[model samples]
Every structure is written in C-alpha cells, then in structure tokens.
Target chain A: MNESWDEIGQLFKNARSIVILSHVRPDGDAYGSSLGLAWTLRALGKEVLVCNEDGMARSYRFLPGSEEVVSTPKTAPQGCDIVIAVDTSTQERLGPTFALWNRKVDINLDHHASNTCYGTWNLIDPLAPASALVCYKLLQALGWTCPKEAASCFYVGLLTDTNAFRFCPLSPDVFRMAAELVEQGADPLSLSEGAYRNYSIGQFHLLREILAQTVFAWENRVAYYRLTPALLKQTGAENTEVENFLTYLQKVSTVQVAFMLEELEPNLTRVSLRSRAPIDVCQIAQRFGGGGHPRASGIRARIPMAEMEKLLLEEIRQVLQ
Target chain B: MNESWDEIGQLFKNARSIVILSHVRPDGDAYGSSLGLAWTLRALGKEVLVCNEDGMARSYRFLPGSEEVVSTPKTAPQGCDIVIAVDTSTQERLGPTFALWNRKVDINLDHHASNTCYGTWNLIDPLAPASALVCYKLLQALGWTCPKEAASCFYVGLLTDTNAFRFCPLSPDVFRMAAELVEQGADPLSLSEGAYRNYSIGQFHLLREILAQTVFAWENRVAYYRLTPALLKQTGAENTEVENFLTYLQKVSTVQVAFMLEELEPNLTRVSLRSRAPIDVCQIAQRFGGGGHPRASGIRARIPMAEMEKLLLEEIRQVLQ
Candidate 1:
C-alpha cells in the first residue's frame, strides 16, 4: 500500500543517514531521481549515499554529484537509517545490491506502472512522466526546496524520459514543472547537450550504416533496419551504441511501425519494435515470448535474422490490414 | 522605432480586413507566427488572410489555417485594410510578395535581432526566442484570448524556433508560455511529430551518405560532411533536403565547429557552419562574403569544393586554437 506524504516526511526527518538505489543499467531517470533525492536530503543536513550497480556512464559524468554515485557496495553501509529505492520497478531490478541489503526497503518511489510495491512505504504515480518528477512532487509536498543541483538532475530525468518532450500525454504540469526547474537554475541547453548531443563519432558511423540499410515495406507504412556483427565491427561501435538507431526509421513520416533487427549471433536475433500509429506492438512481442509497453516492445528470437524478419513482417502485415 | 503594445492593439482593432505575411522559404517560426496571428484576429471577428511567398510545406500543412495560406498573389488582394509581417527579418526576405503589396507594412512583429524594422509600427524583441512568442505577448497585452488553434500554431513556432528548447538563452518564460499554450489545448506530441518527425525516406538516405562521408579534423574538434552532386544523385535527394545535414556533425560530442560543404556547381560550393563551442563561426563566414549568427553561419564560395574545404578548415583551426 502507498503511504501518505506526511508519513514519508516523518521517515525522512527521523533518518540521519540514508541510502538511495535505482535499477541496474541506469538511465537518466534512474540517476536523476536517485541523485536528485540525494542532493535534496544532503541540503537538509542528512547524510545520503547514492549507488547504482553499473555506476555512471561517461556521457552523464558532466552531471553534478555524478562523481558521488558509487558502485553498489558488497555489503550495505553501516548506520544506514533508511533504504530508498527510486525508479526501480521491482526489487529484482536493484540487481545484486538487493541481496546485500538486510533491511526492508524504507520507501520505493517510482513512476512505472509495472512497479511492484516492494517497500515498507511506496510513493508511486504511474501517471507521472518521469520518476524524477515523482521525486520533485514529493519534495514539494514535504515543503522542501530543491537545490539547484537537484533541479538539474531532475530536469535531465524529465527531459530524457520524455525524449526531449516528444513523447505523448505531456500535461500542462509537465511544462510548468520544467519552467520551475529552469527558474531554479536548470540550464536546459547545457543539460540537453550533455544528455542528447553527446553521441560519439563511432556511434555516428554505426548510425550511418543503419540508415543506409533501412528498408521500407507495406506501402512505406513499415520501416526496418538490420544491424549485423560485421556492421558493428566495421563501425567500431558496440552493440549498445545502436539502441537509438530506430529513431531514424521513426523520422519517416509515412512509417506507422518501425523496428530494428540486431544479429546477436548467426542464429540469434534481437528485434525491437516501435509503433507511431494505433498498433499494439507489445501484443506482437508477447506472442514471441517478450513484453513491453504497447508502443514499444522487444523480442529475442533463436531463429536466424532473415527468418525472424519474415515472421515479424507477416505478423505486422496482418495487423496493418 | 518600435510601437507600444497599446498602439499595436489600436492598429489591430481599427483594421477590418488584414493580410499577414511571413518570410520566403518559411520555417516553423514564419508559418507559426503568421497563422497564429491570423487565427487570433479571425477569432475577434476580423477578416485575416495569411500569405507566404513559398506557401506552406506539406509537413506544416497539418497546422490549423494552413490551407488558407496562399502563395504571394500576382498582386495584393482588394480591400486589405493592413499588411502585417510576422517573422520576416527584412523586407527583402518577404520575397516577391513585398513588391505586390502597394502599401507599406502597417506592423512588423518579429523576434529576430537583425530585423530591419521595415514597417510603420514595429514590435521586435531580440530575446523572445520566437517571433510567435512576440505575437503571443501582443495578443496577451491586448487582452485577447488566444484561440485553441492559435495556441497550437504558436506552440509549433516555439518548439521549432528554439530547436525544441535546445537553443541557448531559454528564459523561464519560454516554458511558462509552453504550459499556457498546452493548457489552451495545444497538442505537444502531435505538434512535435508534425514539425520534426516528418522527414522523408529520401532525406534519411541523404543523411546516411552524409554521415558516411563525415570527416573529423583538428583532433576531432572540427567535423564536416560534403554533399556532392554525385551523392545527391545516387540517393535521389534534392539539394534542399541536405540543408540540415550539419545537424549530424553537430551531434558529435567532441566537435566544436561543424560544417557542410555542398557542391552547387563545378566551382561553386556552398558551405554551412555551426559552432557548439564559443568559437565565432560568423567571423569565418564573413571573410568569405557570407553572414549569419555567431553560432550558425553560411558562405557561398566560388572556389572548387576541395579548395573551399581547405580554406574553411584553416579558418576554423585558427579560431579553435
């Protein structure tokens, strides 16, 4: 069950030392929510430690207090008065660090609809655009002001989670929150540069190859790209670098369904699907034993890349028809 | 001299039938500001006609009142009480449409710093970020409520003029205005999709070729791409499609100065320059008889493509040093 804001405030006030955790393979929302809370708590004279399983990425190192986010300790730090997990949908998402913490989660703050109530107290609003936004509203409710550093972190979370405000269901409050954050000294341009325009030369090369091989079918309503091991090797880009390659296909005005097929092995392919129209890609992914949001989903197939592509296309064609 | 909001309101109030004009090769700011103003005036029971020399692009045709925007007529329409220019920086930029209007511009509303103030009553705010914002403020000051359609148009202008809020000097008012517009029924997601994600598949192909030929100089501080006639031919893309090719190079995190050299003819190469760092690209463009803002500028060189590239590289290297 979710706890009231007053109860959460009391918990924070009583705690002298706090530990913040987010999901493994942290994104901006994970780092932003965790660091934002850490900075706010520190401003209130509380000792806060922020931890992530994989630590921080090189691109996001520019964020203030990013240096302070340490790798999840082998054992929980002594005298941790409260354990707060933010942006983690479930306890398992906290990775190996979850096993190290002997105490129950004091609070679980998140915005994911799939978030399990895995804490003694939970403050989850699935309607909130970003977990950082959920954290911001919590601070507002607690009558605590966000520090400039905290504002910057939260702003990154908001910006990245919304894909620079391109995603759907953006409320007026979203813009209002953005305005408040900017007023609180969040540098939108610098933050946007750090979060988005920091792509490496190698990543650009990989994008080039992907764009060149882009294929369109079903009267150009469907677009797809394939990334093979040879392509990755030639571009000197890691598999992770191609995560956003689907954006190029999405940019096509006629495309309703766009996807990427990554050849993980000779007979192993990873397929990512995105829908711009009224299509439930998650349903299709679920058929292949994968799951995600309706608009975006993924599936890992044991079949060869060509076979998987054919199967996915036929499935998509039926849906389109 | 610029006119006060009250004076501008009086002009709008006295007019019965008005013609709104924007610059040629109209971008979102041009289309958005003109249509936004047109919708506001029409809501007040005034007759409004929107005109652009180039008419509306297919991408922006989705905007409300876009269908009403006519190409510059052979001559001005009869019974037009006033001629108002929305986003035109100079009378010349109004293109051949300027000559067709027998009367002088009654009001010139713009946000460009380089605005020539070519109208009898000009309202220009260099720091407003978008001309649509300037127009929005005028409507606000006049105590006129923006129609939902007007709000939608203004939102597009704000989104595109600021490059989706990634540009510099974004004041708190920008986000606040965005919130107000959204509250007034502007659809951010659809508006953004219309403005940004409507690229053609051919454009993507051109971008791929540009990315493949991307060159890094000065230890990666300078990145550039050449759009040769051959590449365009092979991709089956028009020259105009490559206008934003510099954006790909701008995405390179290490790049300080990024540029694109398009071979217009055998000896004529058009170069566009963009600076991420504090390096002034305008000065470099000026030396080659070209001009634009400090961060973004362009030049048309009569020299061959390779020679022009060499000259620009030397110029940028000196500035980078």
Candidate 2:
C-alpha cells in the first residue's frame, strides 16, 4: 500500500458525507478520478456526491456514475465531513464547490507540479499519472474490492493523463495496477470510444483549419499553430473544443519545440508547448508564472498575439541557447 | 566524438559507394534512420544506394532523401565499403537485403530491446528512443552539419519510435540531440502532416470498428480487442490499419494488460500487448518465445482462439497475482 493511503482510507470510512470535486472544464483524468472515487465510495455504502465546475461532454457519459454528477457548485451538499478535490489546483478552478471546502476538511488529491497545497492534507505527487491513480492507491490501501465500474473509471483516468500510455511517463507500477483493474472488469472499447474517439466533427473541422494555418519559423525548428477565438465563434465550437489540440503539433519531423496557442480573448492566449527533447517548458512556463510537466507545459499570458509571439520566441530561444 | 563514428566518417571520406538498408515493412523509425543516414552520407560526397522491402507511402516522400530510395535489393552497389542496416535487428527483419549482408560488412544500428546483435559492429541500445537518434549522434560525432533535411529525417525516426514522446523512455541525451537537430532547421508542420494526419479514411474507419469491438476481461484485469481477417476484408482495411489501434486500447483506465489480437490466418494471431506496470509483457511474451519491452511487448502465435485466449488469460492472471 502507498504511504498516507491508510489515512485516506480511514478518511473515507469515517466520513458521513463526501463531496467529490475536480477542476473546472474537467479533463478526462479529473472527471474520471472524481467519478471513480465516488463510485467506489458509493459501493462502500457511503453518500458520495461528485461535482465539477462544468458539465461533462456527451462522450464521457459511459463512465459508470457520470449520470449522478452535479455540475453546479452552489448546489453542493451542506455539512460534509470531507471535501475532496480530485485534480483542481487553484481555488478559482473549483468553480461552484469553492465554498464547500470552507465548511469542512479539505483533502486535495492532484498530480500537478503547481498544486498550491490548499488542502489540510495535501497529496500532490507531480510524478503521479492521474488523480484517479491517487484514488486507486487509497482504495487499494483500504482493501476495497474496487468494483468493476470503479476500476473502469480509474483506467480511463490513467490512460487519458498518460495519453494512452504514450506520454504520462508512467512507471512499471502504473501498468501493474492497471492490470489488476482489468482483471476486475474495465472495458477498453468503452474507454477508447469515450476518450479518444470523442473527437466530434466540429473538432475535426477545427483541426483541419488549424493545420492549414500552421506557421513555421526560426528556420522550421520552431513551429506553431493556433486556434483563433474568431474561428471558434465561427465554428460554434465550445471553449473546451480547443483542449488537447497541442497533441496535433507533435507529428512534425523537424520541430524541436511545438506550440499551439489558443486565443482565449482579444488579448489572452493560452500557450501549450511540447518539447521534442532537451527543452524543459516547465522552466520556460515558470518564467511566465504558469507551469506543467517537463515535456508538455502551458502558460496563459494575456498579451497581443504579435507581442506574445515575439516574447515567446525570445523566451524559448533562451532555453535553446 | 562517438568511438566508431569517426571511422564511419572516415569511411565516408574515402569510400564512394554506400548502401542503406532498413528493417522489413519499415516504419517511420526504420525509414527515417535510413533516410537520415543516407542524406548524411550523400552530403559527404558518397554515392548512396538505399533499398528496402516496403513500398514507400506518400507520407514518407517528405523524408529528405526519400525520393532517392530504391525498393529492389538488386540496386545495392557491389563491393560497398560498408552496408549500414539503419534499424534492422534480426537478419530476417533485414527484409530483401539479408543476402547482400553475407558479402559485406554489416553495421547494424538499432534501438529495439530485442536486438539480436548480428552485425560486425552492433550499435544497439534499447534505451535510445530510435535508430534515427543514433544516426544523429553518429553524424554529430562525425562533425557533420545536420542539414534541415537530415534533421527532418532524424525527427521522424525519433517522433515515430517514441510515439511522439509517449513510447520512448527518453533520457537527457535524447533531448540534447534534438536540440542540435533543431539548430539545423527541422520543419515540424510538414512532419506532422506527413506522420500523423496522413492516415487514410479507410484506416480511420477501421480504427472506429476496433474501438467499438474492444473487450475487457475485468476479472482477469486484462483488456483485449481483436481484428479478424474477415473483419478487415469486410471493411477493406489492411494490416497497416493496425498501426495506432493499440494506442486506443492503452487508454482504458481499468485495463492493466491491453492487447490487440489480429488474425494473421485461419487460426494464427499476432498479439500486441501494452502494459502499465508490474507485468513485463516481454517476459510474458517470451513464454511463447516472443519478446519485446517491459511495458509494450509482442508475440505471434498460431493457436486456436479459445486456447490462445485461455493461455493469455492464465498468463495475465499470474502476472496480476
């Protein structure tokens, strides 16, 4: 059993009410973790409420307990013994459930390197593949059977964060745990369709336009593509449609640093950078006060595109030099 | 400088004929390594003869020296000073050029963990991401400028083998070499289109079916999906469609042991497995005399579907236990 998991197991055992919350506009990892944990808690005969800042997409409904998720933070259950944030880092990221934490013990479970330790008992291992992985460890330490539905939820969380075992830098232990889950009945077909094939036609069209608009610079070693707010408005694609677009930029053969800049507003750009090798975007992102993993890191900088490009090029160039 | 790279550089300085051969049904790693190395040799004023068993896909045409490749083994120059097998490990995997190596000095450069060490000079480091990375190091040690073209080829090899940095258990050295390649101008946009978005509609449709049909044995904690010859024939998808299908399976949260069973014949199956942790598929595969890396491993066995399933389940059960 993982260290500190015993405490988490006891925390679940003693709790009369639990509210499970994750980051706003939750990713597969966050949503999966919250639901997986909630499912296991419910299986254990506890009253568990799962919530997020926003509603989940249609594709993710296959998750066993997704239908029970309540999106509005203001509707959070009162007087919970514990409030667990699955993958949310900042308080602002907690959305409606932001207030729920003030009334009870806050347990933060995250894998982000930038976690602020806002919870009383912070379990933030940046090296962890996903929040569900953390939840799985807690469940395992508690000696729970980890029902089939719960295992599936955890599996989805692991695979999504790791990009299907291609990026998360998962350890041998992750796979072993996953194997145990599979034995318990996690369906890959359902997860893949939910996770990877969730790419709607709208996202596909948006991808085509972004690909066409790609720009090469610094003699092709540096390449970037962007999803403009105007295009999103034109396509009627939601803000979340822009998620995971950075993955598309990596196929280039000569690119050392790949950037996917999404325009959030007139002057705000969310920059996602993936380094092929040697360049740690975490360090680069830290300079901008935004950070993520070493390979794929992001920084949200509010500035004109022209200025943003120049500053970013200068910053990235510094790392290369 | 790499110990023997100077020897290769010197060989290029004095030798006029060079034959580049790659592994069978060459992938991006194999093709990229061959093309990256051939371009470097050509830059040194050598007459390069590149041959392989696989037909070139249009996506690969963008490779720097791809336009110069020869598919027939007969085109190999006679009495070449050195025959560089860029990414081939075993002799049979050398494809059509296996016989030619009998008459020449074969320098095998590979990154496969299952390398057979068949060359007079074997450069096999499973830890390295790809043979293209090795080729880049060799070129660097030779003090050659990694032209934009060479970088492009090297990038493809690295990008593909690492599954875009998802597959390769990369280290600091890989990134450093990537930085050197970037200094010489590798265009990422073109590479993305060539390597990723180039998937055909047929392949996409096939992927959809595979995603739909994936099966998860929750009790055994093994998730599996299969593609039958009948299914491929019905869908008009080929073995090539199997390329990225395993990635879809690897995403399932509950599946620790993810597998793709492709029917090679009436009763033959090509089993590809991806593990998240404790299970070493390589050792598991070696039980059937097949082998691969610890996390992602493979084996080809001809057995009844029921028997194969049972055997695989038994092994998986043991690995999980």
Candidate 3:
C-alpha cells in the first residue's frame, strides 16, 4: 500500500490535467472522495474533472463542489494526462465511463477489499472505513493543505460511510482524523444535518406503510418488513428512500437479524439483510449468489415475496439453531 | 466561573471524604459527571460516594463503578468534609438527599445556565455542551490525569447528552475532547453501542403502532402522534421507552413542530413537543404550565386526548401564522 501510495503520488506529480471518477450511483463517500481530490488537485493548479455515469444524488448536493460534477463519458480536455478512479472496487462499477477512459487507470484509491487492482498503481486498504480517509492520507503525504471545502467533502464521506459512527468497526484513529477535519473547517453538526436529517415527506409515508406490515418471528429475534410496489405507488416514495429501512429492525435488542424485502416487480424480490448478533448475514446472501459486508448483505430472487421471505426466515432459523 | 473553579479546586484539595450528587432520575450527563468526578476524587486519595435519589438507569449500568452509586439519601461517612453537586441545577433537583446534607454545598459543578448557585462555590458554564465537559475541564484545571475508567464515564455522558454528536449545539471542542478520551482508552464504538444500539423489542413494536397512526397537519409542517394506554398495552411498551418517539417526526424535511401526546390516565394527557424550525415549542409548553429547552419541551393537560390535540393544533397554527 505504501509503495502504491508513492507511485500514485508520483503519477499526480507528473500529470497536469487529471480526471477523477468514482462508482456509479455514487454515495456520500464516492462524492466526497472525488470532490475532495478534485479540490486538492485544483488547489495545486492542475486542471481536474470529476465524473460519474449516474449523477450525484439530491441528498448529496449539499457538498461544496458537487455542482462541478460532470456526467460520465464527457470529453476531457485534449491535454488530460492522468485518470484516477476513486472508491470503485471493480472496473465494471465505473459504469460506461470505464470504457470511455480508454487508457489504463493511472491511480486507483479505494477501501474495498474486493478492489480489482485495475489501476497501474492501486492504494487499497480494506481496513480503512471510507475512501475519503484514503484521499485525506494521500493529500497529507503529498504535502497538500486541506482547505475548508475539501475538508467538508471528506467529513461528509466519513460520516455517511460509518453511518455517523454508529458502525462498530470505527477505530479511534477515525475520530482523531475527524477532529483534524473539524480544525480544517468541517462543521460536523451541519454536515450531519445535511446527510441524515433531510428526508422527503414521501419517505415518512413510506415508512408508515412499511412499519404497518412489519412481521416478527422466532420469538421476535427475527424481524422483517416488506415494501411492495403498490405501497411505493401509494406513498410516492422512490426506491432510494428504503436504503435505511433495515436500521429500524437492526436496533431491536432481541433481533439477531433483520430482513427487508423490496418487490422490484410483480414476481421479483430484492432482499437486504442486517445482522446485529454473531450471525453473518453476508454468508446468507452469498448462498443466494449475492454478497456484502458481514453485517449487511443483499440478493435478488426471482420469486414472489412470500416464497422469498419463507426461504430467508428458514435460513435464519437454521443458523440460529 | 473562574473564581468558583479556584475555590472548588481548593476545597477538593483540602477534602478527605467527599459525597458527589447529581439530579434525580439521572441521565447520561448526570451519571457521567457524578461518576467521572467520583473516579477523579478517588484518584486524589479521597473517599467518594456517588448518589442519586432515583438511582442510575439500567442503560447506564455499563459505566464502570456504577454499582457503587448509592440511591440516596444514604448516610455519608462521619467526617465527610465536603458535599459536591455535579450536574444538578437546583436544590430540589438534588432530591430529598439535598436536605440530608446538613452543611452547605462546598462545590456545585454544572452546565445549566439556570444553576441556582445553592453551593458555597459554583462552577457553571452554560456554554458547555454537557456537564461531563465541565467535569473534564475541572479535572484539567486541577491537574488530574483521567484514567481509562474515568474517561469512559465522561465519554458516555458526552455521547448521550449530544445524541452521539448529532446535535447542532456541539462545537469542535467536543470532538477534540472525544479524541482525548479515546486516547485515554474510551472506545467510541462500544460506548455508542451501549448507549444507542441496545433497544428493547417492545420499542420496535411501539414504533410500528405509532407510525401507523401518525397525523400530519398544517400542510405537513406539523406532525403529531399519540400513545394511548390501549396501544401501549397492546405493544407491551413501557412509558419510558416513548421518550424519544418525537424524533420520528423531527427528521421529516418539512416538519416545524412534532408533538407526542401520551395518555397517562383516562383524562390526563402528557404532551412532549419537539421543534426543528424557528418556532419555540418551549413557549407553547409554558402556556400549558410546563417548560423545557427551545428544541424540546413538555406539559401535561387534564383534558382528554382529543381536546388536547385540538388545543395544540390551534396553538401551532397561531405560531405558524
């Protein structure tokens, strides 16, 4: 990782115009790292562009330089010499922009253990909580001062990736870095408000619909909720609003695993699982040809919600027993 | 405040046996300040007794030395040279134990702006985010090294009072202090889990019932939910679990005020108000003969739930217009 960091720093030093891209459907971490690195490069008098095939989410527009984000496959300046991929583990995760780059990835900075090492130089630390932390370290090693704008972007990324530090893997170094970011002018409270507090009216209605249908089994140790297409239509809630629905069950002290089933179509179901106990939901997801972090995982099943729920519950019951 | 700090420090320096007390029905800040100060005094070779009239909550039993907390008015050792109130603002908030202290309070440490100054020397800084911060400052002023145990106690108080640092009132200094505590061996993730992730099964059922009947008014600017005896009984939820129910509404993007009405008896309604906008729910609560902070307040009415809802809606409409 240190060798890759030095190599990436050398590449940045050698390039004048650089383009930075993150994964499609970018979350706060993706936006934060891309924008933060973009701002840092701009500060060094380099021409820079940040791109994603799927544009920034409305929730993340509060980021300082989000307005500068360009849609993917945009033509870069003639002199663009370096391309950096951030927060993307696999090449395909770059969406159409992966083919648009046409050149080898000069630098790949990510925190996912699954990173494909598609770059000429890769700096990946799976232990790091967020890619924004990697970006901050890179800037520090390169002797760049993180101004207020860059700090805000990085802070937001860290906040979102850690679920505002409620995730168990957060180390003390994360908090120390957070303190440094605050010194660099990241207002944590305001960033938190923008990232977590902003919720659409439709989201509340959607929550009501989902909660009303919540079911518990296995002595309340296994709780599950489903969001049907009809409920979505009635509440006018977009799919993204359900991203955090699993948390409502994850907090139950007695619940070992919580399942969220979203009906993507009449007969297809997308299931998200969250486990708070020693149980590994990732293993369960893998059985369904899906995977994620140990505590959170997902899969898509080509079956009705009823059948899918039964299969998932039986799997959990087997695991618990 | 500085003058009182010096006097308080001198008293600590001269004392052999000290009894530390916080408000009745102690919250995290109350437990944090009292326990932190107790540990600090113990480090100074002083015999310390931590007491609260209503005892520590089950949630805070994780704090080190929590078992040592004496639900008061317990007898202090003979030669207990000083009486210290760590987080209590008024003598009454100290509970019946206040009358047990025959001598005047030698030191009163608090963060409330309305501290009654019932002590011979009072160290109160309303600007401080939590009483634990004040206690940490006090220990620092007196040149004390906070061991791992003491740091954990203080960290819990800061974490709980600031709602895990999501509150807008938290400043950069709080993060810095949090960093120092982590360095002293306080684990932020575990502290957070102990304080937030440990929710009862009944709480989720209670949330479901409440969300199913959430009411929105005034163009969705005001949202309210009521917990009746029947619903609570059905969900098997205790009254204490509903303390944070209003937060369910506070996160709504357009909500100005969120009201939580709980029927304590057939005709007695206890109303808790939370506001996110410029409207002062405290003022509204005051008109109902109850009061609290600007963002959160509460009151009780002898009228039925339907009549109370009418009165509240009318009051909120008046404020909005």
**Maximum-TM-score candidate:** 1
Model 1 agreement with the true structure over A1-321: per-residue lDDT tens digits: 376877788888999999999987688889989999999999999999998888777667868899999998988899999999998877877988667766688899998877788999988898888999999999999999899999999999998888788846789999999999999989998998888778777787788778778899999989998888898889887565466777778888888899999898899988989887478898899888766667777788798999999999999998983
In model 3, how well does chain A match by TM-score? 0.91
- lDDT for model 3, on a 0 to 1 scale? 0.81
* Model 3 Cα lDDT, one tens digit per residue, A15-70: 88998989876889999999988888899888998888887777688899998887
Using all chains and alpha carbons, the TM-scores for the candidates as numbered come to 0.94, 0.56, 0.90
| The TM-score obtained by chain A of candidate 1 when compared with the true chain A | 0.90
Chain B TM-score by candidate, in order shown: 0.91, 0.90, 0.88
Interface RMSD of each: 1.2, 12.2, 1.8
Model 1 DockQ class = medium
Candidate 2 lDDT over A1-321, as tens digits, reads: 123766767777789898887887678888889888888888878888887778776657778888888775664477677888888777667875566545433788888877778787787777777888888877766788788888889988987876665533445466566667666777654565567645444554565466556676775567687777788867666667464765555544456677877777778878878876566888888787777778777788877666777888888877773
Of 1 and 2, the candidate ahead on TM-score is: 1
Best by DockQ: 1
Q: What is the lDDT of candidate 2?
A: 0.71
Once fitted onto the true fold, the runs of candidate 1 whose alpha carbons sit more than 4 angstroms away are A100-103, A228-230, A263-269, A300-307, B100-103, B228-230, B238-241, B265-268, B301-304
Order of the predicted models by lDDT, top scorer first:
1, 3, 2
Ranking by DockQ: 1, 3, 2
User: What TM-score results for chain B when candidate 2 is compared with the true chain B?
Assistant: 0.90
> What DockQ does each listed candidate score?
0.77, 0.04, 0.59
lDDT over C-alpha atoms for residue B222 of model 1: 94
